[model samples]
Target: MKWYKKWLLIIVAIFVMIPLFIGIIQHNKKLPSHISFEGPTYKTDELEFLYDLTYQKNEERVLEQQLLGTALEIINEAENFLVVDMFLYNDDYDRDKGEYPNSAQKITNALVEKRKDNPTMSITVLTDAVNTLYGSTNNPYFETLEDNNINVLITNVKPLRDSNPIYSSIWRPYLQWWQPSQEGFLPNAFNPDGRKGSIGSYLDLINFKANHRKIILNESRAMLTSANLTHDGSSYHSNIGFVVQGDILKDIYLSEQAVANMTGYTLPDVTFKSSNETNGELEIQLVTEGKIKKALLGALAEADEQSTIKIGVFYISDRQIVKGIKEAAKRGANVQMILDPNKDAFGIEKNGIPNRQVAAELVPNKNIEVRFYDTNGEQFHSKFVIVTDEDETTLIGGSANFTRRNLADYNLESNLVINMPKTHVLTKEINDYFDRMWNNDDGQFTVEFEKYEDQTLWKKAFYRLQEFTGLSTF
Candidate 1:
């Protein structure tokens, strides 16, 4: 070969090999301490299940939101120290869409008021970098919280595994040095009229990982929910939550501390009063990252002929979870799922690539049934699964959706695993919540499987490709 041709071939090989090497190392790198964690199971009597619902009644949308209200109440009742980690904490929405509740503003006011009332109290708010559009624009909410002496930390998601490794591998080596700045003319992908973002912001956005944990806790109690504090565009989206008081709060605090440590912030030292009692009726465990997937799989594996599995989630495209559901159905367990139709993202239409294709794969079994929530202009953003046997009920829920990005250690996710007797009030309440939506008792909540069924061959191929390669967002 000619000398010049040999050098050119070497250069081409280098360009291809660099990203491949980076992608492999980053995906399997040793995560920060306590990334994928599973807290010990604690028994306690203080477990409350709360949910929010938006349904059409008499041609009008009726909102029955309880999770955010309960979260605000928790914020107001904190006395000494407060630690909150929310995925979304901004009020950016389409202003042309009539009127919507300023949920983020309400949370800010509550935090500021509480800070004013207790000047010595320690308050820390942790949120994802997406709220700032990957630091291209300033977040007003973070500024307001900092102005009130509240510590606000944007989680450093770089250390987390790259979900979209194909793009992130190239960007990490070549373009990650381009820091996002406020001076840019590119249209923001989230909000068109919002502050324009820089090329660096768009580059960072393609990495597609986040600290997607919605949690609030003081020394005494903690609440884990699927709802974000920013509800401007999704105020009426259905959601769910759980409030508990016990040693589990320590586990939650420790999880947040791990994120804080990654972000170079130290959380205030606040000791929790543990309920030493272990045999209480309600048992709870805090699971994060891949642990959430483990807990769900364990619960599903235990389902048998006499068992029933109920899942209500915004997205359900994880392969293992899909196989688990099918195996459970094959074992003669009744499996019913309430899924969003993969449509309506802040007034933007979405192609039903995932859920519709997944539902098509699931509904063939006689024991399995699937239904899509009847969303008018909002979404069914709840994420929880309930598996009931003759003796006990297992409920897994929090911010983690059943997706590769959310469950496979790619994103920082948090969830709670609650195990209680069949007769427990919390279990009954959760079952009732599912039944109301499944049966549409007095409300037009869910539609039949035929409503949005899609068996498109290309979409199925696309969903499989996206789920396997982590190329598309769930």
Candidate 2:
């Protein structure tokens, strides 16, 4: 070979090998101590389940939203301090599609009003960087909060492990050095009419890691939910939330503190008073990151022939979870799943990649039943599983979805596990909620599995590849 050709070959190999080495090192490096946290199980009687529903009743779109109403109430009642760590907090949606409730603006107004009413109170809002398109633009809601003397902290997701390492490894070593600027000429990835994003921001977005926790807490109570403050062009998406008071508030506070600490911010010193009341029949535990997966698998493992497992989630592409559900069904446990059809993004249509393919895999079993949430331009975004045994029931729900990115420590996630006797009021309420949707008691909430079942061989292969490689968004 010619000398110049040999030198060029060497340069190509060096460039290729560098990113490969970085990817492996970053993937296996020791994570922050607080990443996959499992808080102590606390027994308390101050748990309330809140949900939002958007269903079709007699061809009319009916909306019954209780989650955000309670969240606003919590903000209003907090006198001393308020901490909100939401994954999405923006109103950058396609207005041509539909009219959303302006949830992001509502949340901002509530916080600003509270701050004005209690001038001395400490208010901090922590949110993912996606609201600003990874710092390529300024979010008006955050700006309003900051201007009102409230602290707005954009979570630094760089410290979190990269979910899409195939792209991030190269970006981290080659492109991450350039900080994304607020001014840009490129069109916005989320909304074309919105502010443009810089090339650096787009590069950073390809890393595909986020602090995907949705939590709101004060000095006294905490709430964890699957709802984002932002509507994302779909205001009527279904979601679930839990509000609790007791020592569990401290656990939620500490978990948020970890994120603040990782991002080099110090949360104000506040104490959560323990309830002196008697322990209720329910037991609650807080789990974050990978620990959510551990708790979920543990609950599934306890199922028996006499048990019933019901899952309603936005996404379900995690292999272990899929396998666990199959195993439980094989053990004679009745398993039913309600999943989104994966057919709607902001306003754009989506190929039913993961959920439809996943449902196709599970429905082949005689014991496993699956249904698609009947969506009309909105998604069914609830992420919860209920396992009912003969004497007790276990419920797991919160921000984490049953997907590799959300549950495998790649994205920061939080969830709560509740255990109670079968006769408990909360247990009955949850069971009734599931039955209402599953059976379409009062509305057309769900449809037969055949409505969106796809057995396409290539799509199944694509789903597996995307789930494993983190190449596509869940």
Candidate 3:
């Protein structure tokens, strides 16, 4: 063989082999094993479980409830330290929608004001690089936070497992080195503006993993939410949030620190001890990815003929959870699920891939019933599962989508488990919310399965492929 020809072959092999190795490393990244589903429970009157809904009547949009107000109120009252990890934090919407109230900007302003009031206060914000399209575009919200001295850490998700191997294999070796240069040729997929992004950004988007948690921690309290402080999400979705004050808050703070450590950020010196105060007999547990999945499975398995399970989710494509629900139903457990139609995303139409197919999977069981949330061009973005029996009730919820990527430790997530008697106020609140949606009380929050039932073979197969491969946008 000619020497130059052999050299060219060797160079090609290097490029191929390097990316392959990187993909392997990312797929097998180590996960923290110490994180568990056991946490302290506070019995204070400070626990706030809130939900928000956007509805249109007489052609006027009305926010039925403002759940995020609690989070903003927490920021306003903070005096010592504040730590936040919001997944989405931008105002980029479809150009046709014009402009909306920038939730990220609101959060930025709140942090800036708090810092100005107490110059010595510590503030840290952790978010995903997708907000910047993997460095292709700049995030003005994060830039503002940094300028105001609020420490901002974009989560380094590259160290985590690759959800989409086909994309990451090429992205790992070649595209990552070339920064995205928004040549203004192609339209921005996220917003309505005519801004463009490079092919590198598209490759980054296809990697299919994220830091999907939303949390806020301060000296006064801590909160975990399923809502993004982004304007698009704020205006057109139904979301849920929970706030707690006690030793559980300390556990939550530690969980936030663990996520920061993954991105090589040195967390501030903050120690929140468990408060020895009790208002009732409620216990809270902080559960992340694997732990969250395990806790959910355990709760589902606990249900029997006399028990019932009510699940409300934005996405529902996890096989194990699906299997658990089916098996529980087989055992005569009453299983009811309210799921988003998965047909709308800020005016963009989706194919209803996972949810519709998943509903089809469950509808055959007599004991299991499913319904579609009547989103009216919005998304039903709540994620909560409640298992109830005559004696006690178990509530598990947070920012997790019931998808493989969100449950298999491929993406960072946070969920809370509250184990209490069936009569507890929090338990009653959760049950009532599920009941109202299930019964279509007050407003038409849900519709019968016949309204959007889909059992096509191709969609089912496609959903399974994406769910198993972590290739879908759950």
Candidate 4:
């Protein structure tokens, strides 16, 4: 063969083999079954439900968000061990924002102090590599934790299914092997012009999967939330969480240990088992990843003429669940959704895509009501579903967004499925929360679909494309 022709053939072979290699690894990636544990649920008096609505009113910002505060409290009060798996745990906001409240740093400080107080205590923080921009840069906050003898587990994405296969195909064979050089050359993906990343970091940005669970497991209690410890995320975003003190904490610990094991972290021989003792009247189930989708589908299938389903979520792009919801509305179940408009991220403004389009799809059904979560400057970053029947009420909530990447087992997500008596205090409180937001009581929690409805054909196509292809940030 001619020398030039041989070189061209080599390049073509490289392109072809890379994708095949990625496909092989992605197909063979091992993932355990989604953990589900059902135990006695606690009532309102037995457990605390922490919720805060961060908003702007009268030209002033009201940051009532308290999920991070509760997480910090749990860490400070932990006596033996502290395990946290957070999706985002870095200070990566745009510098133009002018130094936001550094929540991640504060949490790190608390952990460091706790270690100092009791040098034998164990602290492990598991977080996504996105905080470090796919290992392109170093996170000072995480480094500080490690400096204090805390164990930091950055999730190994190699075992995760490729969400954006096009990028993963190229990234796997060539760039995946490149060492993450701290010798900065490229601008930081999170905050450009502040800190630079290595070439490998830029390459890894193409793979858009994450360990998105926001869980804090301590000896006495456990919390599952939709809030991140990132400085930018803490102040301006509205979030929600559940803090339970029961046998469920042990279940949470085991589930978190599974995540640690995935990244090759050998947790101490911790004896964690559900005590099987009753905490209160509410019955709880810990559902993760694909199990959550199954529970959601089953609950939607149960909706009937007399049932009402209310959802407030950050994103909703899962087709099976969406279709089930539509079917429920068609069957005379009252269905309502207050979804984020997908309008802003950090300092970037976005056009409403998935939420608006989803709203438009259900608008034609009289039994369905769709509204946009009213926001001042930040996103309504909560993911929850409440279903009420004549006798029983069910609430599913946690860090999982209703999107393909979030539900299809591509991301490490955890949620709680609670079935309680219709008249139970916890049930009443969740119902009241929906009612307050729906009625615009006290603050403007939501606006009618007409306020920000975007049914543009192009956007519908775009949302579907991203949701289907997994080339999205949701």
Model 2 lDDT tens row, 336-358: 99999999877778999899999
The lDDT values for all models are 0.90, 0.89, 0.81, 0.80
The C-alpha RMSD of each candidate to the native structure, in angstroms, is: 1.3, 1.4, 2.6, 2.9
Q: 3 or 4: which has the higher lDDT?
A: 3
Tens-digit per-residue lDDT, 319-406, candidate 3: 9999999988888899999999999887688999899999998999879999998877678998999999879998899989898888
TM-score of each: 0.98, 0.97, 0.92, 0.92
Model 3 scores a C-alpha lDDT of 0.81
Q: State the TM-score for model 3.
A: 0.92
- Report the CA-based lDDT of candidate 2 relative to the real structure: 0.89
Runs with alpha carbons beyond 4 Å of true place in candidate 1: 273-278
Model 2, stretches more than 4 Å misplaced?
1-9, 232-234
State each candidate's clash count: 0, 0, 4, 1
Q: For residues 76-122, what per-residue lDDT tens digits would candidate 1 score against the true structure?
A: 99987999899888877666554568888988999999999999899
Model 4 per-residue lDDT tens digits across residues 151-249:
999988567677777677777776788877778688776775556788877777768888899998887778898888655544668778988776677
Better of 2 and 4 by lDDT: 2
Candidate structures ordered by lDDT, highest first: 1, 2, 3, 4
